[model samples]
Structures are given as structure tokens and as C-alpha cells.
Target: MAGRVKFGVVGLDEMLHGGLLRASICAIVGTYGTGKTMFALQFAYEGLNRGEKVIYISLEEREELLRATMAQKGWDAKVFDDRFSLLRLDPTDFNLAINSIKSELPALIRSTGATRVVIDPISLFEGLFTDESIQRQEMFGFIEMMRDEDCTLVLTSETDVRDQNGSKYGLVEYLADTVILLRYIRSPGLTEVHLALEVVKMRRSPHSREIKPFEIQEDGIMVYSEASLF
Candidate 1:
């Protein structure tokens, strides 16, 4: 049974109407400084907290940096070293990157017995495909292939530089079962920036559609689902 996979963010789960459906794919799309990586990490750590094995495949940040960020949030990797698998994929190498993700990731998931998997900044993976037609075809196939796995997948994507609310390659949002959009709203005077998120889409489940305020705190991301943006 595909159950609810809690994202570990406070009110974000409420917005998701409990959590993401297990064995489903979720895309978190946002521009720079929107905390896409933070959200992905929180999802991974949450799974660990729930006694489930997790695999984090990073296409951007190195493993050390990710671990340090988690360490700052008080997650002691050593405590769950056996349950966590963190690997860094060099996006610069097209063949190797494509081969590793498309060929090795599923096998690694099964070997690790991981129930939660994250590909932080999967936009890089999408970017590797230069041809739009090929990109769409490959991503659609990739997402479908992931559906057969027992683990839930979370993919972080950069917003199209031209369109703030859309995914970079414009494929992940279409292929994923759920899409969460993160945006930075500047105050009237442009004195400060506030982060807001919306449950853009969720299949097979009810979710809150309202855009809500959120903050990236020292411990983790806190979504103020009950608060009003206006």
C-alpha cells in the first residue's frame, strides 16, 4: 500500500493533506535562495527519523556540504550512518551522470532497502539533455521507471530562468505526481524577502492550494500554513 510520506516540514505536511502518497514522485521547483535543497534534505532526514532508510543523490552540492547542513540542523549522521546513503553525482560529465542516475540509482535503492530517495537539484540532470524532445522523452521514461520502485522520490528543480513558477526543463512538474512551488515575495518596500509556497498539484490526494508563508530556520523549514500571506 502506498501510504502517506511525511515531508518533515511543520505545516507543509498539513498543506499536503497529511503527506505525499508513498511510491510517488514529487517535484519542488524554485529559483535560487528559495530553499529547494533545504526542503529536499528535510524530506530525507524525516524519513530517517521515522526509521526508514533514505538515499540522497545530489547533482549539485557535494556530500560533505550536504552533511554539514544536516549537522547544523542537529541531525547526527553517525547515528544513522547505516540507514542513510548519500552520493554526489558530477553533473559536468554527461555520460557518467546519465549512466549513474539512469543505470545505478534503482539498483542502489534496492540494495540499500531505502524507502525514501531524493535527487536534489534534479534540474541538473534535466539540463544534461540538450535536445528538448529528447529531454521530454527521457524524463517521462525516467519518472515512469521510478514508479515501479518501492521508495518515494523527491526531485528538486530550478525554476526556468525565464519563468519563476515553472520547472527548468518543464518536464518534472508534468511527470511528477505532486508539485510544490517555492517563491520569494518581496515586501512592499523591498526591505525584506518572504518565502511562500503553494501545493500546485497533487494526484490521488487532497491538498491545500493556498500560498502560505514559510521560513528556513536553523533547525529546518517551517511552513506557516495557518498564516495568511495577505
Candidate 2:
């Protein structure tokens, strides 16, 4: 717990072998309704609970909605006013979005002395480039830039429409130090659908490779690490 950055999701942290390595990048790859934002919120709140400053940059959700979500989970974002910074970036505005993250993010991080940063659904950010090659290049540069900083970074990315296991832009998994894949698992005869998650890759740490069931509860996410799908 001292060296790792905990997601603070019940069983997911066990699957992550305590948590992510400090100062490393993690990618949460999943399709919509797979609790990607929920996981991001937990990661940010974990830092706040530790009396650490956190910066949550949401590209899809508005500031008020994010705060409302936290409120539903019984997390008082207002209480951590000085320590928690919830930023809503308009992904539709290309130049503003690009300039803000690429140029001002580091400065903001330093100014706030944040120890944890979360970017929910970084796919939109990747989409801004338009060209595949440019996107890859820009992401690589962005990752390197973050590496120079001291905080841990968590990026949530939407999976490709064709493949639920693949990231939308197909670049985050390669750039991030850890990649957690979330997807839907349908039982035989299509009677029931279960949500499952697995650690696809962890660069410098040992992690559970097994796929386990999880649920989005009223409070937050809970991964059934002890329960087996089989």
C-alpha cells in the first residue's frame, strides 16, 4: 500500500497485487456501462481519503454530474474542496481540449501538488488526432511527459466496437504500464449476463490473470475475486 497506488475497489486491488506501481500509468479498457467511470472515481477518491490531492479530468461527464455521482456513493466531494479537483474538459472543442491537457495539465498538477490523476475515457483524447499515426505519436509523447511527473496516472479507454478486448484507439494498452480489461460475459442460452474483469497486462508487477465476476453496486464496484465463473 505504501509503494502502490490503490484503485480502492474492493477486490480489484487484490487482483492488482496491492495496487498499481507508484508513478506508473494504468489503463482501464472497457465498453460503455462497464463501470469505467465508477472505477475512476474510486481511484480518485482513494487518493483523497489518504489526505492526498487528486485531479480527476473527465472528458465525457460534466463536473456537476461527476460530483452527483460521488454524492450518490456517499462521498462528500465538497469536504475535500482543497484536495479534490474535478475538471470537465469539452472534448468537442479540439484546440482547447488539446491545449489544456497537453500544455496545462502538468502545470495544474504541480500547482495543486496532486499525487493521483484520473482521465475517464481517454479514447476521446485519442480521437482528437484523427490520424492513427499522429494519435500514437502524440500519446507516446503524452505518456513520457507524465512519466516526468511524480503522480500516478490512470486512464480509462473505451474498447473498440469490433473487439471488446481491444482499446478504442489500440494505443493505450501499449503505452500504459498496466491494463485492466472489463467486458460482458453471457452465460449459455443467454439467460444471464455477467460483468467480468481481468488484468490483461502489468509491466513491473505480478497480478491475477484470472477473469473474475464484478458488479456495479449502489455504492461502488465490487470484484468477486474469490468467486469463479466456471
Candidate 3:
């Protein structure tokens, strides 16, 4: 494995013992308002800062909306220009999106020599598959193909309210090389809600198992490695 890719989130790269392994797929799973998208954006932004070509594919939000969000964060989305590309695919047209991704993504990566890629809310795409078997097969293939590319990938997924695990489909956690879980934990009285992030799994890398507190600030997501859940 080559050098790890920094998450760009302050204090997070250290927890992973440097950063995410190169060309590996990491699944960022969380519920709504848990800052999953922010984490993904931070990863791409960090790549851009390092002069690495980056690509972001959003299945839930429009490109304009993402740009607006970036602008709110004081990041000039236009500054990166040609080095960064944000593509939004309609989740409603599942077949077309899946086909396009499989057929066109490789070419895009090759043409741009992108070194970082993010798939925001892959859960929506997985929901289109009615059969569990087919879902697993297709997901496995997709992950493998992404890994084959010379890029580090971050895929976001939604978690159910009742489920303890972070992924809605559950298969993404297994398919990905690393799994990062994010959730909102309420105090005993339900009066205080705290955001926590955990590295559930990181193949071939020794990562922190502790659940640490985090915050979604104007700049981006910040993980407190030294803090405890309580």
C-alpha cells in the first residue's frame, strides 16, 4: 500500500495512523444531520489543496446547491476550477445512473487523472436494487472497479434510526475497505445530543476504536480525537 490519504479533517488523520490507505474505498455511514456529506466534501477539498484531481458525485443534491454550501463555508468553489468536478445524478433514474457510472466513470478518471473521488449518499443508489443478491453483486463490482482506479474513494451511506450499525443496506460496510460510523448520541435525559464518530473498521490499518466527539463547523467537520463520548 502507498502512503495514506489525509482526511483533511483536523485531528482525524492521526486517528487513522496517518490517513486512509491509497486507492482504498472508505464508507462514511451516518444518519441525517450527522455531517456525512461535509466529511466527503472535506476529503475532496483536501485533495484539491494537495493538487490532486478530485471528483464528487452526488446522488441527493444538485451541483448548484453543493456550490452554495461551499460558498457558505467561505470556500471559493470556482478557485479549484478544472481540478475539481462535481456531478449530480438523479436517483430517480436508477438504471440510467448506474449504467452511466459503470460505463463513463472509468473514462472520466482516466481523462482527468483524478486521485480522489466521493460518492455522496450511495444508499439512495443501492435502494434502487430490489433483490439483495443483485445488490451485493453489483455493489461488489462497483467497489472493485473503483479500487482499480488510481484514486482514493469515499462513499457515504444512510443509516436507519433503529439500526445500531451505520449502513442502511449493510452490504457497503463489507464491500468497502474502511468503515467510518457517525451518529448523534443523546444524553440519558435526551436533553443533550452529541455528535460522535468512530472508525468501525479499517482493513490492514490499525485505527482508533474509541467513539470520539465531533462538530460540524463553518469550515468543515472537526473530530476531537482526545475527547470521550460522555
TM-score of each: 0.97, 0.98, 0.97
Error of 2 at 78 (Å): 0.5
Candidate 2: worst 10 consecutive residues by lDDT? 1-10
Q: Compared with the true structure, what per-residue lDDT tens digits does model 1 show for residues 52-168?
A: 999999998989999999999988977999999999999999999999999998999999999999998888998898889998888988888898899999999999989998998
Candidate 2 ranges beyond 4 A from true positions: none
TM-score of predicted structure 2: 0.98
Clashes of each: 0, 0, 0
Q: What are the C-alpha RMSDs, in order, of all predicted structures?
A: 1.0, 1.3, 1.1
As a TM-score, model 1 comes out at: 0.97
TM-score of 3: 0.97
Tens-place lDDT per residue, model 2, 6-110, is: 889999999999999999999999998999999999899989999999999999999999999999999999999999988999999999999989999999999
Cα lDDT of model 3 by residue, 107-133, tens digit? 999999999999998898888789999
Model 3 bad stretches (over 4 Å): none
Question: Model 3 Cα displacement at 66 (Å)?
Answer: 0.4
Candidate 1 — worst ten consecutive residues by lDDT sum?
185-194
Rank by TM-score, descending? 2, 1, 3
Collision pairs in model 3: none
Per-residue lDDT of 2 in model 1: 60
